[model samples]
Target: MALKQIWEETNMKIIVKDLSPVLLQTKNVFEVADQKLFRYGHLVLPCLSQNYGPTYFCKLEKIN
Candidate 1:
């Protein structure tokens, strides 16, 4: 349900170096941001990294 909604809204292409599947699974657990507050033409990734607590890594493209 959430995935469908995400696909419908915007493109989600991110790169998490050295990130395991466990981290990937954890990454998806994000509450949708308020559109009014957030800027347009953007993709937000709410993540929990070992160094960062509840961080956001916004990506607009897929890089190698």
Candidate 2:
């Protein structure tokens, strides 16, 4: 599913490169942000390098 679809269905807000307490998932791993956040996924991959690469998978949801 598309990111927008996921957001609408899950009612979650996701901000790439923005620090927040939102949920983030990558390659089956889900992480709850406590600090800085980065953008990942298909679109972000091209701009990323080997040292700092984008996550292959991602999922997010609201806390409250």
In candidate 2, what are the lDDT values of residues 1-64, reduced to their tens digit?
4766857887666643432323343423433332324354332333233344344544444454
lDDT of 1 by residue, 1-64 (tens): 3444666785774443432333446445543334345443223434455333333433343453
Give RMSD (Å) of candidate 2 vs. truth. Answer: 9.4
CA lDDT of each prediction against the hidden true structure: 0.42, 0.43
Give per-model TM-scores. Answer: 0.22, 0.24
What is the Cα-based TM-score of model 1? 0.22
Model 1: colliding residue pairs: none
> Local error of candidate 2 at 34, Å?
30
